[model samples]
Target: MAAKDLSTMYGLSESDPEQKLINRAGMSASDLEQIDRIMAEMGRMRQIERRIMRSSQEFMKLNETDMRALRKIISAKHAGRSVTPGELSQYLGISSASVTKMIDRLEAHGHVLRTKHPTDRRSQCVEVTEETHLAARDQVGRHHAKRFEAASRLSSEERDVVIKFLAGTSDAMESSLGSPLDDDAR
Candidate 1:
């Protein structure tokens, strides 16, 4: 499609609200190209991300719900906070009862611990056990090492550029979308 046609599809005509907004912001063709490049890079990155996630899930032998819960627990723990089942439910947008069930399974498997909440007598906080911590660290390290080994086949500068671009792209995306996994909602 022509650039004009493509832009129109996105509601970017001269008379459209989007064009007026772009004009007020003084966006140029290069800026638009940068946005386009970033979006294209995002698409490629998503494909790679999905493959990596699938491979990691397979390596960990985790199903969808288990993986989701584990990720929430690990991420929260990594941020130095014990997450309540209710908080996890809110974060995952699931029912609290479902989170409770998942937490039970995780606790039973020794991956997580449920303890009385410090401030709430009726609530419990979920904490990752040492086993979960060690397992995550080891698995991530192996996956990263493998990815690095593959990248090493590229010229040093190319590898560095790719890594830098991906990091920057990730940061930009996180800033734009508020979360890395937000796109997964679609």
Candidate 2:
């Protein structure tokens, strides 16, 4: 596999400190092969994600965090709710100061807006702009449409298999991490 592909698949870069450690760990050859296949498929999925994010960044001049913030705000607005900086901090697993900087950058770029909260004048609500929503529909949403089409084309049995596999994988990951997957932790 290409170096970048390996890195993306295993969440490692060129200077992985744990590579040697993992290599010497006791495991059967069959077990190693299974792990290899799983990483390869995960790498393929990362490529698909790269396509979507790159298109969104090119269209909106935003980074991954900015794109995520916009998506979250849009979701909240659609749900008739508002997002605050503290909530975003908790959701994104970042510090409040970092969230402030993010909010400032997005607001300056006209991607998000900060307005007074209805109940508390001292607090603010963050929301995605209409222009960003339109841009998302044109870029990232188009990518999702293609993926949905691909999924739809799968046979019922194939889809069921995929669903079960994904669900089991998600559960395994959560158990390994000792934490539940938060809805806003994407």
Which candidate achieves the best TM-score against the true structure? 2
- TM-score per candidate: 0.54, 0.72
Please state the error at residue 155 of candidate 2 in Å.
4.5
Candidate 2's TM-score: 0.72
Candidate 1 residue runs with Cα over 4 Å from true position: 1-41, 141-186
Please, what are the lDDT tens digits per residue for candidate 2 over residues 1-186? 443434334632222446763563686767765666667677788787888788779879988877877778888888999999988988888899999999999889888888889898999999888888888878887887998998999999999988998788788778989978777543
lDDT for model 1, please. 0.71
Clashing pairs in 2: none
- Candidate 1's residue-wise lDDT over 21-97, tens digit each? 44536778787665655555555656777887777678667667677677677777778777788878877778988
Residue clash pairs of candidate 1: none
Displacement of residue 151 (Cα, Å) in model 2 is 2.3
Best candidate according to lDDT: 2
Model 2: lDDT of residue 158: 96
